[model samples]
Target: MRFGPRLLMALGAAASLLAACDSAPITGRSQMMLVSESEERQMGLQAYQQVLSKEALSHDAQVTALVDKIGRRIAAAAERPPGELWRAPRFRWEFKTVDNKEPNAFCLPGGKVVVYTGILPITRTEAGLAVVVGHEVAHALARHGAERMSDQMVAQVGATAAGVALAATVGGSNRRYVPMMMAALGAGATVGYLLPMSRAQESEADRIGLVLMALAGYDPREAIGVWERMRAANTGKHTAEWLSTHPADSTRLADIRHWLPEAMRYYRPRD
Candidate 1:
Protein backbone atom coordinates (compact mmCIF):
# COMPACT_ATOMS: atom_id res chain seq x y z
CA MET A 1 0.00 0.00 0.00
CA ARG A 2 1.05 3.64 -0.58
CA PHE A 3 0.96 6.52 1.92
CA GLY A 4 1.06 10.31 2.09
CA PRO A 5 2.36 11.94 5.27
CA ARG A 6 1.56 15.58 4.52
CA LEU A 7 -2.13 14.80 4.12
CA LEU A 8 -2.11 12.57 7.15
CA MET A 9 -0.29 15.18 9.23
CA ALA A 10 -3.01 17.70 8.45
CA LEU A 11 -5.63 15.15 9.50
CA GLY A 12 -3.72 14.29 12.66
CA ALA A 13 -3.73 17.94 13.70
CA ALA A 14 -7.33 18.47 12.67
CA ALA A 15 -8.96 15.09 13.44
CA SER A 16 -6.40 12.69 14.95
CA LEU A 17 -5.55 10.37 12.05
CA LEU A 18 -2.47 8.12 11.76
CA ALA A 19 0.25 8.95 9.21
CA ALA A 20 2.90 6.89 7.36
CA CYS A 21 5.65 7.80 4.87
CA ASP A 22 8.48 6.51 2.61
CA SER A 23 11.56 8.03 0.98
CA ALA A 24 12.14 8.37 -2.76
CA PRO A 25 15.42 6.65 -3.63
CA ILE A 26 18.64 8.57 -4.38
CA THR A 27 16.95 11.80 -3.36
CA GLY A 28 16.05 10.32 0.04
CA ARG A 29 13.07 12.43 1.11
CA SER A 30 9.77 11.27 2.55
CA GLN A 31 6.95 11.73 0.02
CA MET A 32 3.17 11.34 0.04
CA MET A 33 2.61 8.41 -2.31
CA LEU A 34 0.20 5.46 -2.04
CA VAL A 35 0.69 3.34 -5.16
CA SER A 36 1.72 -0.32 -5.00
CA GLU A 37 4.51 -2.04 -6.91
CA SER A 38 2.10 -4.54 -8.47
CA GLU A 39 -0.32 -1.84 -9.58
CA GLU A 40 2.54 0.17 -11.13
CA ARG A 41 3.87 -2.91 -12.94
CA GLN A 42 0.46 -3.58 -14.47
CA MET A 43 0.17 0.05 -15.61
CA GLY A 44 3.63 -0.04 -17.18
CA LEU A 45 3.03 -3.32 -19.01
CA GLN A 46 -0.37 -2.29 -20.33
CA ALA A 47 0.93 1.11 -21.47
CA TYR A 48 3.85 -0.56 -23.24
CA GLN A 49 1.52 -2.91 -25.12
CA GLN A 50 -0.79 -0.08 -26.13
CA VAL A 51 2.07 2.04 -27.51
CA LEU A 52 3.50 -0.84 -29.54
CA SER A 53 0.14 -1.79 -31.00
CA LYS A 54 -0.74 1.79 -32.00
CA GLU A 55 2.58 3.02 -33.39
CA ALA A 56 4.18 2.08 -36.71
CA LEU A 57 7.60 0.56 -36.23
CA SER A 58 10.42 1.87 -38.38
CA HIS A 59 12.17 -0.53 -40.77
CA ASP A 60 15.36 1.51 -41.11
CA ALA A 61 18.29 -0.79 -40.43
CA GLN A 62 20.62 2.01 -39.32
CA VAL A 63 18.21 3.35 -36.73
CA THR A 64 17.41 -0.17 -35.57
CA ALA A 65 21.09 -1.01 -35.02
CA LEU A 66 21.83 2.27 -33.19
CA VAL A 67 18.91 1.83 -30.80
CA ASP A 68 19.72 -1.83 -30.18
CA LYS A 69 23.35 -1.06 -29.41
CA ILE A 70 22.63 1.83 -27.03
CA GLY A 71 19.48 0.40 -25.40
CA ARG A 72 21.12 -2.81 -24.21
CA ARG A 73 23.98 -0.90 -22.61
CA ILE A 74 21.63 1.46 -20.70
CA ALA A 75 19.38 -1.42 -19.56
CA ALA A 76 22.34 -3.33 -18.25
CA ALA A 77 23.23 -0.33 -16.09
CA ALA A 78 19.65 0.29 -14.84
CA GLU A 79 19.57 -2.25 -11.94
CA ARG A 80 15.94 -1.70 -10.87
CA PRO A 81 12.31 -2.75 -11.43
CA PRO A 82 12.47 -3.91 -15.06
CA GLY A 83 15.65 -5.77 -14.12
CA GLU A 84 14.65 -6.91 -10.61
CA LEU A 85 11.35 -8.16 -12.02
CA TRP A 86 13.31 -10.96 -13.68
CA ARG A 87 12.14 -13.10 -10.77
CA ALA A 88 9.56 -15.45 -12.32
CA PRO A 89 11.04 -14.76 -15.78
CA ARG A 90 7.97 -14.35 -17.97
CA PHE A 91 8.41 -11.24 -20.15
CA ARG A 92 10.99 -10.31 -22.77
CA TRP A 93 12.33 -6.77 -23.35
CA GLU A 94 12.31 -5.28 -26.83
CA PHE A 95 13.57 -1.96 -28.31
CA LYS A 96 12.12 -0.54 -31.50
CA THR A 97 12.35 2.68 -33.49
CA VAL A 98 9.29 4.40 -34.91
CA ASP A 99 9.18 6.42 -38.15
CA ASN A 100 7.79 9.64 -36.77
CA LYS A 101 8.90 13.21 -37.48
CA GLU A 102 8.56 14.43 -33.92
CA PRO A 103 11.72 14.95 -31.87
CA ASN A 104 10.44 12.79 -29.07
CA ALA A 105 11.00 9.51 -27.27
CA PHE A 106 9.71 7.73 -24.18
CA CYS A 107 10.11 4.52 -22.25
CA LEU A 108 6.85 3.13 -20.93
CA PRO A 109 6.44 1.54 -17.49
CA GLY A 110 7.71 -1.76 -18.76
CA GLY A 111 11.02 -1.95 -20.67
CA LYS A 112 9.26 -0.89 -23.88
CA VAL A 113 10.85 2.16 -25.62
CA VAL A 114 9.87 4.23 -28.64
CA VAL A 115 12.48 6.38 -30.41
CA TYR A 116 11.41 8.80 -33.09
CA THR A 117 13.78 9.18 -36.06
CA GLY A 118 13.30 12.91 -36.29
CA ILE A 119 15.47 13.40 -33.23
CA LEU A 120 18.42 11.65 -34.89
CA PRO A 121 20.02 14.74 -36.37
CA ILE A 122 19.99 16.42 -32.96
CA THR A 123 21.46 13.36 -31.23
CA ARG A 124 24.08 12.83 -34.02
CA THR A 125 26.30 10.37 -32.17
CA GLU A 126 26.27 7.11 -30.18
CA ALA A 127 27.05 8.99 -26.97
CA GLY A 128 24.35 11.58 -27.68
CA LEU A 129 21.81 8.79 -28.12
CA ALA A 130 22.94 7.28 -24.83
CA VAL A 131 22.13 10.56 -23.04
CA VAL A 132 18.58 10.60 -24.43
CA VAL A 133 18.02 6.93 -23.68
CA GLY A 134 19.37 7.18 -20.15
CA HIS A 135 17.06 10.10 -19.17
CA GLU A 136 13.91 8.46 -20.56
CA VAL A 137 14.83 5.13 -18.95
CA ALA A 138 15.39 6.91 -15.65
CA HIS A 139 11.79 8.14 -15.79
CA ALA A 140 10.53 4.55 -15.97
CA LEU A 141 12.82 3.16 -13.24
CA ALA A 142 11.77 5.90 -10.82
CA ARG A 143 8.11 4.95 -11.40
CA HIS A 144 7.35 8.62 -12.18
CA GLY A 145 4.13 7.94 -14.04
CA ALA A 146 2.87 5.86 -11.13
CA GLU A 147 3.88 8.64 -8.77
CA ARG A 148 1.86 11.00 -10.96
CA MET A 149 -1.25 8.81 -10.82
CA SER A 150 -0.82 8.15 -7.09
CA ASP A 151 -0.66 11.92 -6.55
CA GLN A 152 -3.95 12.31 -8.40
CA MET A 153 -5.55 9.66 -6.18
CA VAL A 154 -4.34 11.39 -3.04
CA ALA A 155 -5.71 14.78 -4.13
CA GLN A 156 -9.08 13.39 -5.23
CA VAL A 157 -9.61 11.48 -2.01
CA GLY A 158 -8.00 14.01 0.33
CA ALA A 159 -9.89 17.05 -0.95
CA THR A 160 -13.30 15.34 -0.84
CA ALA A 161 -12.71 14.03 2.67
CA ALA A 162 -10.94 17.12 3.99
CA GLY A 163 -13.53 19.58 2.73
CA VAL A 164 -16.33 17.70 4.45
CA ALA A 165 -14.29 17.47 7.63
CA LEU A 166 -13.67 21.19 7.59
CA ALA A 167 -17.36 21.79 6.99
CA ALA A 168 -18.27 19.60 9.96
CA THR A 169 -15.81 21.44 12.20
CA VAL A 170 -16.47 24.92 10.87
CA GLY A 171 -19.82 24.94 9.01
CA GLY A 172 -21.60 23.01 6.11
CA SER A 173 -22.28 26.10 3.97
CA ASN A 174 -21.50 26.39 0.18
CA ARG A 175 -19.92 29.81 0.81
CA ARG A 176 -16.93 28.09 2.40
CA TYR A 177 -17.02 25.24 -0.17
CA VAL A 178 -16.68 27.30 -3.39
CA PRO A 179 -13.55 29.26 -2.38
CA MET A 180 -11.99 26.16 -0.77
CA MET A 181 -12.43 23.99 -3.87
CA MET A 182 -10.96 26.60 -6.19
CA ALA A 183 -7.98 27.12 -3.89
CA ALA A 184 -7.41 23.35 -3.74
CA LEU A 185 -7.29 23.09 -7.55
CA GLY A 186 -4.67 25.82 -7.92
CA ALA A 187 -2.56 24.75 -4.96
CA GLY A 188 -2.91 21.08 -5.84
CA ALA A 189 -1.33 21.67 -9.25
CA THR A 190 1.70 23.56 -7.90
CA VAL A 191 2.21 21.50 -4.75
CA GLY A 192 0.82 18.24 -6.07
CA TYR A 193 2.49 17.69 -9.47
CA LEU A 194 4.25 20.70 -10.97
CA LEU A 195 6.48 21.93 -8.17
CA PRO A 196 6.99 18.47 -6.62
CA MET A 197 7.90 16.54 -9.77
CA SER A 198 9.15 19.33 -12.02
CA ARG A 199 12.29 20.21 -10.08
CA ALA A 200 12.96 17.09 -8.01
CA GLN A 201 12.11 14.44 -10.60
CA GLU A 202 14.39 15.95 -13.26
CA SER A 203 17.21 16.07 -10.73
CA GLU A 204 16.60 12.38 -9.92
CA ALA A 205 16.65 11.48 -13.61
CA ASP A 206 19.94 13.32 -14.10
CA ARG A 207 21.54 11.44 -11.22
CA ILE A 208 20.28 8.03 -12.33
CA GLY A 209 20.82 8.60 -16.03
CA LEU A 210 24.40 9.68 -15.52
CA VAL A 211 25.16 6.56 -13.51
CA LEU A 212 23.44 4.43 -16.13
CA MET A 213 25.44 6.04 -18.92
CA ALA A 214 28.66 5.74 -16.96
CA LEU A 215 28.04 2.06 -16.28
CA ALA A 216 27.19 1.62 -19.97
CA GLY A 217 30.74 3.02 -20.66
CA TYR A 218 29.65 6.07 -22.59
CA ASP A 219 31.43 9.23 -21.41
CA PRO A 220 28.81 10.43 -18.93
CA ARG A 221 29.92 13.95 -19.81
CA GLU A 222 28.50 13.50 -23.28
CA ALA A 223 25.17 14.24 -21.72
CA ILE A 224 26.17 17.87 -21.29
CA GLY A 225 27.08 18.23 -24.96
CA VAL A 226 23.89 16.44 -25.95
CA TRP A 227 21.72 18.87 -23.98
CA GLU A 228 23.64 21.79 -25.45
CA ARG A 229 22.68 20.53 -28.87
CA MET A 230 19.14 19.97 -27.63
CA ARG A 231 18.93 23.61 -26.55
CA ALA A 232 20.40 24.84 -29.81
CA ALA A 233 17.98 22.70 -31.78
CA ASN A 234 15.07 24.47 -30.13
CA THR A 235 16.54 27.83 -31.35
CA GLY A 236 14.21 30.74 -30.48
CA LYS A 237 12.04 28.76 -28.08
CA HIS A 238 13.57 26.87 -25.16
CA THR A 239 10.07 25.81 -24.14
CA ALA A 240 8.69 22.71 -25.77
CA GLU A 241 6.52 19.74 -24.76
CA TRP A 242 9.64 17.80 -23.74
CA LEU A 243 11.04 20.73 -21.77
CA SER A 244 7.75 21.36 -19.97
CA THR A 245 7.27 17.73 -18.85
CA HIS A 246 10.94 17.10 -18.06
CA PRO A 247 11.79 20.51 -16.53
CA ALA A 248 13.57 23.62 -17.76
CA ASP A 249 16.67 22.77 -19.83
CA SER A 250 18.71 25.27 -17.82
CA THR A 251 17.67 23.71 -14.50
CA ARG A 252 18.31 20.20 -15.75
CA LEU A 253 21.66 21.20 -17.22
CA ALA A 254 22.72 22.84 -13.96
CA ASP A 255 21.63 19.68 -12.14
CA ILE A 256 23.79 17.62 -14.49
CA ARG A 257 26.76 19.69 -13.35
CA HIS A 258 26.04 18.80 -9.72
CA TRP A 259 25.76 15.03 -10.40
CA LEU A 260 28.84 14.72 -12.60
CA PRO A 261 31.22 14.11 -9.70
CA GLU A 262 29.03 11.33 -8.32
CA ALA A 263 28.34 9.78 -11.71
CA MET A 264 32.03 9.80 -12.66
CA ARG A 265 32.67 7.47 -9.76
CA TYR A 266 30.83 4.77 -11.73
CA TYR A 267 32.05 5.72 -15.21
CA ARG A 268 34.21 3.13 -16.97
CA PRO A 269 35.84 4.96 -19.84
CA ARG A 270 35.35 3.17 -23.17
CA ASP A 271 38.37 1.22 -24.49
Candidate 2:
Protein backbone atom coordinates (compact mmCIF):
# COMPACT_ATOMS: atom_id res chain seq x y z
CA MET A 1 0.00 0.00 0.00
CA ARG A 2 1.12 3.54 -0.65
CA PHE A 3 2.28 5.42 2.46
CA GLY A 4 -0.49 7.47 4.16
CA PRO A 5 1.89 10.34 5.04
CA ARG A 6 3.00 10.80 1.43
CA LEU A 7 -0.58 10.79 0.16
CA LEU A 8 -1.62 13.30 2.81
CA MET A 9 1.30 15.56 1.95
CA ALA A 10 0.40 15.54 -1.71
CA LEU A 11 -3.20 16.44 -0.93
CA GLY A 12 -2.09 19.26 1.35
CA ALA A 13 0.15 20.75 -1.30
CA ALA A 14 -2.64 20.62 -3.90
CA ALA A 15 -5.07 22.36 -1.56
CA SER A 16 -2.47 25.04 -0.88
CA LEU A 17 -1.90 25.55 -4.58
CA LEU A 18 -5.62 26.01 -5.09
CA ALA A 19 -5.81 28.53 -2.28
CA ALA A 20 -3.72 30.94 -4.30
CA CYS A 21 -6.52 31.19 -6.86
CA ASP A 22 -9.19 33.86 -6.56
CA SER A 23 -12.74 33.15 -5.43
CA ALA A 24 -15.89 34.38 -7.13
CA PRO A 25 -18.24 36.73 -5.30
CA ILE A 26 -21.40 34.64 -5.09
CA THR A 27 -20.14 31.08 -5.45
CA GLY A 28 -17.15 31.81 -3.24
CA ARG A 29 -15.27 29.05 -5.07
CA SER A 30 -11.58 29.60 -5.71
CA GLN A 31 -10.89 30.45 -9.35
CA MET A 32 -7.79 30.82 -11.48
CA MET A 33 -7.54 34.52 -12.44
CA LEU A 34 -4.91 34.83 -15.18
CA VAL A 35 -5.85 38.31 -16.45
CA SER A 36 -6.36 41.58 -14.65
CA GLU A 37 -9.76 43.29 -14.38
CA SER A 38 -8.73 46.38 -16.35
CA GLU A 39 -7.66 44.33 -19.36
CA GLU A 40 -10.94 42.43 -19.33
CA ARG A 41 -12.92 45.67 -19.25
CA GLN A 42 -10.76 47.12 -21.99
CA MET A 43 -11.41 44.20 -24.31
CA GLY A 44 -15.10 44.29 -23.46
CA LEU A 45 -15.36 47.98 -24.28
CA GLN A 46 -13.50 47.67 -27.56
CA ALA A 47 -15.43 44.60 -28.60
CA TYR A 48 -18.74 46.28 -27.80
CA GLN A 49 -17.78 49.36 -29.83
CA GLN A 50 -16.71 47.19 -32.76
CA VAL A 51 -19.95 45.21 -32.69
CA LEU A 52 -22.12 48.32 -32.54
CA SER A 53 -20.24 50.05 -35.33
CA LYS A 54 -20.50 47.04 -37.61
CA GLU A 55 -24.01 45.78 -36.84
CA ALA A 56 -27.39 47.36 -37.62
CA LEU A 57 -29.61 47.82 -34.56
CA SER A 58 -33.35 47.42 -34.58
CA HIS A 59 -35.49 50.20 -33.14
CA ASP A 60 -38.55 48.15 -32.33
CA ALA A 61 -40.24 49.68 -29.29
CA GLN A 62 -41.24 46.31 -27.85
CA VAL A 63 -37.75 44.80 -28.15
CA THR A 64 -36.01 47.67 -26.41
CA ALA A 65 -38.49 47.58 -23.52
CA LEU A 66 -38.14 43.84 -23.14
CA VAL A 67 -34.31 43.91 -23.10
CA ASP A 68 -34.13 46.83 -20.69
CA LYS A 69 -36.72 45.29 -18.39
CA ILE A 70 -34.84 42.03 -17.99
CA GLY A 71 -31.33 43.51 -18.00
CA ARG A 72 -32.06 45.87 -15.15
CA ARG A 73 -33.30 43.04 -12.98
CA ILE A 74 -30.35 40.72 -13.54
CA ALA A 75 -27.74 43.39 -13.00
CA ALA A 76 -29.36 44.61 -9.80
CA ALA A 77 -29.82 41.12 -8.41
CA ALA A 78 -26.34 39.85 -9.14
CA GLU A 79 -23.84 39.85 -6.32
CA ARG A 80 -21.40 42.76 -6.30
CA PRO A 81 -17.83 41.92 -7.16
CA PRO A 82 -16.18 40.25 -4.17
CA GLY A 83 -12.80 41.98 -4.44
CA GLU A 84 -11.73 45.58 -4.56
CA LEU A 85 -10.33 45.28 -8.05
CA TRP A 86 -13.65 44.62 -9.85
CA ARG A 87 -15.92 47.38 -8.71
CA ALA A 88 -19.18 47.72 -10.66
CA PRO A 89 -18.37 51.34 -11.41
CA ARG A 90 -18.36 50.85 -15.15
CA PHE A 91 -21.66 48.96 -15.36
CA ARG A 92 -24.46 50.72 -17.25
CA TRP A 93 -26.33 47.58 -18.37
CA GLU A 94 -27.21 48.81 -21.87
CA PHE A 95 -29.15 46.42 -24.07
CA LYS A 96 -29.47 46.99 -27.79
CA THR A 97 -31.43 44.85 -30.23
CA VAL A 98 -29.21 44.26 -33.21
CA ASP A 99 -30.65 43.11 -36.55
CA ASN A 100 -29.07 39.71 -36.78
CA LYS A 101 -30.66 36.32 -37.26
CA GLU A 102 -28.05 34.39 -35.33
CA PRO A 103 -30.29 33.66 -32.31
CA ASN A 104 -27.47 34.74 -30.05
CA ALA A 105 -26.71 37.21 -27.27
CA PHE A 106 -23.79 38.18 -25.03
CA CYS A 107 -22.82 40.25 -22.01
CA LEU A 108 -19.58 42.20 -22.12
CA PRO A 109 -17.52 42.99 -19.06
CA GLY A 110 -18.85 45.97 -17.03
CA GLY A 111 -22.44 44.94 -17.84
CA LYS A 112 -22.65 45.90 -21.53
CA VAL A 113 -25.07 43.46 -23.21
CA VAL A 114 -26.77 43.00 -26.56
CA VAL A 115 -29.37 40.65 -27.98
CA TYR A 116 -29.73 39.78 -31.60
CA THR A 117 -33.17 40.44 -33.08
CA GLY A 118 -33.33 36.85 -34.31
CA ILE A 119 -33.50 35.74 -30.71
CA LEU A 120 -36.63 37.83 -30.07
CA PRO A 121 -39.10 35.44 -31.63
CA ILE A 122 -37.51 32.60 -29.70
CA THR A 123 -37.78 34.57 -26.49
CA ARG A 124 -41.54 35.16 -27.03
CA THR A 125 -42.12 36.96 -23.73
CA GLU A 126 -40.41 39.35 -21.30
CA ALA A 127 -39.77 36.59 -18.80
CA GLY A 128 -38.30 34.44 -21.52
CA LEU A 129 -36.02 37.32 -22.37
CA ALA A 130 -35.07 37.60 -18.72
CA VAL A 131 -33.84 34.02 -18.77
CA VAL A 132 -31.34 34.84 -21.49
CA VAL A 133 -30.20 38.15 -20.02
CA GLY A 134 -29.92 36.73 -16.53
CA HIS A 135 -27.76 33.85 -17.71
CA GLU A 136 -25.39 36.22 -19.52
CA VAL A 137 -25.21 38.55 -16.54
CA ALA A 138 -24.47 35.61 -14.28
CA HIS A 139 -21.55 34.72 -16.54
CA ALA A 140 -20.06 38.16 -16.04
CA LEU A 141 -20.70 38.23 -12.29
CA ALA A 142 -18.85 34.93 -11.95
CA ARG A 143 -15.91 36.20 -14.01
CA HIS A 144 -15.84 33.06 -16.12
CA GLY A 145 -13.77 34.88 -18.75
CA ALA A 146 -10.80 35.41 -16.47
CA GLU A 147 -11.05 31.90 -15.04
CA ARG A 148 -10.94 30.52 -18.58
CA MET A 149 -7.82 32.56 -19.34
CA SER A 150 -6.17 31.21 -16.22
CA ASP A 151 -7.03 27.67 -17.32
CA GLN A 152 -5.30 28.28 -20.66
CA MET A 153 -2.22 29.69 -18.96
CA VAL A 154 -2.01 26.67 -16.69
CA ALA A 155 -2.31 24.32 -19.67
CA GLN A 156 0.54 26.07 -21.50
CA VAL A 157 2.77 26.12 -18.44
CA GLY A 158 2.18 22.39 -18.04
CA ALA A 159 3.09 21.75 -21.68
CA THR A 160 6.31 23.76 -21.46
CA ALA A 161 7.32 22.08 -18.21
CA ALA A 162 6.73 18.64 -19.73
CA GLY A 163 8.72 19.60 -22.84
CA VAL A 164 11.69 20.65 -20.73
CA ALA A 165 11.55 17.47 -18.66
CA LEU A 166 11.51 15.30 -21.79
CA ALA A 167 14.47 17.16 -23.26
CA ALA A 168 16.44 16.68 -20.03
CA THR A 169 15.74 12.94 -19.87
CA VAL A 170 16.19 11.90 -23.55
CA GLY A 171 18.92 14.46 -24.37
CA GLY A 172 16.58 15.57 -27.18
CA SER A 173 13.72 18.02 -27.85
CA ASN A 174 10.31 17.12 -29.19
CA ARG A 175 9.34 19.30 -32.12
CA ARG A 176 5.88 17.76 -32.07
CA TYR A 177 5.12 19.91 -29.03
CA VAL A 178 5.92 23.05 -30.99
CA PRO A 179 2.38 23.04 -32.33
CA MET A 180 1.28 23.21 -28.69
CA MET A 181 1.95 26.95 -28.69
CA MET A 182 -0.94 27.30 -31.12
CA ALA A 183 -2.97 24.99 -28.93
CA ALA A 184 -2.54 27.43 -26.06
CA LEU A 185 -3.74 30.36 -28.16
CA GLY A 186 -6.61 28.26 -29.51
CA ALA A 187 -7.45 27.07 -26.03
CA GLY A 188 -7.50 30.63 -24.72
CA ALA A 189 -9.95 31.65 -27.41
CA THR A 190 -11.84 28.39 -26.99
CA VAL A 191 -12.33 28.93 -23.29
CA GLY A 192 -12.14 32.67 -22.70
CA TYR A 193 -13.54 34.20 -25.87
CA LEU A 194 -15.13 31.63 -28.12
CA LEU A 195 -16.58 29.09 -25.68
CA PRO A 196 -17.92 28.49 -22.23
CA MET A 197 -16.02 27.62 -19.09
CA SER A 198 -16.34 24.60 -16.75
CA ARG A 199 -19.49 22.72 -15.78
CA ALA A 200 -19.39 24.59 -12.49
CA GLN A 201 -19.66 27.92 -14.30
CA GLU A 202 -22.62 26.77 -16.36
CA SER A 203 -24.36 25.36 -13.30
CA GLU A 204 -23.76 28.53 -11.33
CA ALA A 205 -25.17 30.69 -14.13
CA ASP A 206 -28.40 28.72 -14.26
CA ARG A 207 -28.87 28.92 -10.52
CA ILE A 208 -28.07 32.60 -10.20
CA GLY A 209 -29.86 33.53 -13.40
CA LEU A 210 -33.12 31.97 -12.33
CA VAL A 211 -33.04 33.99 -9.15
CA LEU A 212 -32.15 37.17 -10.98
CA MET A 213 -35.12 36.81 -13.30
CA ALA A 214 -37.47 36.06 -10.48
CA LEU A 215 -36.31 39.10 -8.54
CA ALA A 216 -36.83 41.22 -11.61
CA GLY A 217 -40.57 40.38 -11.50
CA TYR A 218 -40.14 37.74 -14.16
CA ASP A 219 -41.43 34.20 -13.82
CA PRO A 220 -38.48 31.85 -13.64
CA ARG A 221 -40.61 29.02 -15.05
CA GLU A 222 -40.52 30.84 -18.40
CA ALA A 223 -36.85 29.83 -18.71
CA ILE A 224 -37.86 26.28 -19.61
CA GLY A 225 -40.14 27.54 -22.38
CA VAL A 226 -37.50 30.00 -23.58
CA TRP A 227 -34.92 27.26 -24.12
CA GLU A 228 -37.47 24.97 -25.67
CA ARG A 229 -38.40 27.65 -28.14
CA MET A 230 -34.73 28.29 -28.85
CA ARG A 231 -34.25 24.60 -29.51
CA ALA A 232 -37.19 24.58 -31.85
CA ALA A 233 -36.04 27.70 -33.72
CA ASN A 234 -32.51 26.60 -34.61
CA THR A 235 -32.95 25.14 -38.13
CA GLY A 236 -29.26 25.27 -38.91
CA LYS A 237 -27.46 22.39 -40.62
CA HIS A 238 -26.56 21.12 -37.18
CA THR A 239 -29.77 21.62 -35.26
CA ALA A 240 -27.78 19.35 -33.03
CA GLU A 241 -25.65 22.30 -31.92
CA TRP A 242 -27.40 25.24 -30.23
CA LEU A 243 -24.52 27.68 -30.54
CA SER A 244 -20.84 26.94 -31.08
CA THR A 245 -19.90 29.01 -28.05
CA HIS A 246 -22.38 27.73 -25.50
CA PRO A 247 -23.15 24.46 -23.75
CA ALA A 248 -25.08 21.82 -25.67
CA ASP A 249 -28.76 22.76 -25.49
CA SER A 250 -30.01 19.52 -23.94
CA THR A 251 -27.19 19.41 -21.40
CA ARG A 252 -27.74 23.03 -20.48
CA LEU A 253 -31.51 22.59 -20.17
CA ALA A 254 -30.98 19.60 -17.91
CA ASP A 255 -28.59 21.59 -15.76
CA ILE A 256 -31.23 24.32 -15.35
CA ARG A 257 -33.69 21.71 -14.10
CA HIS A 258 -31.17 20.27 -11.63
CA TRP A 259 -30.49 23.67 -10.07
CA LEU A 260 -34.07 24.95 -10.09
CA PRO A 261 -34.72 24.08 -6.49
CA GLU A 262 -31.63 25.87 -5.22
CA ALA A 263 -32.20 28.93 -7.39
CA MET A 264 -35.74 29.23 -6.09
CA ARG A 265 -34.33 29.77 -2.62
CA TYR A 266 -33.15 33.23 -3.62
CA TYR A 267 -36.12 34.10 -5.80
CA ARG A 268 -38.02 37.23 -4.77
CA PRO A 269 -40.74 38.47 -7.03
CA ARG A 270 -40.80 42.16 -7.73
CA ASP A 271 -43.41 44.32 -6.05
> Candidate 1 — which residues are off by over 4 angstroms?
1-20, 80-92, 159-196, 240-243
Query: Which one wins on TM-score?
Result: 1
Each model's backbone clash number? 1, 0
Q: What local lDDT score does residue 180 receive in model 2, on the 0 to 100 scale?
A: 33
What would you estimate as the lDDT of candidate 1?
0.63
User: For model 2, what is the alpha-carbon lDDT of residue 81?
Assistant: 30
Residue-wise lDDT of candidate 2 within 212-234, one digit each (tens)? 67656677888888877776775
Local accuracy by lDDT, each model: 0.63, 0.63
lDDT of 2 at 203: 63
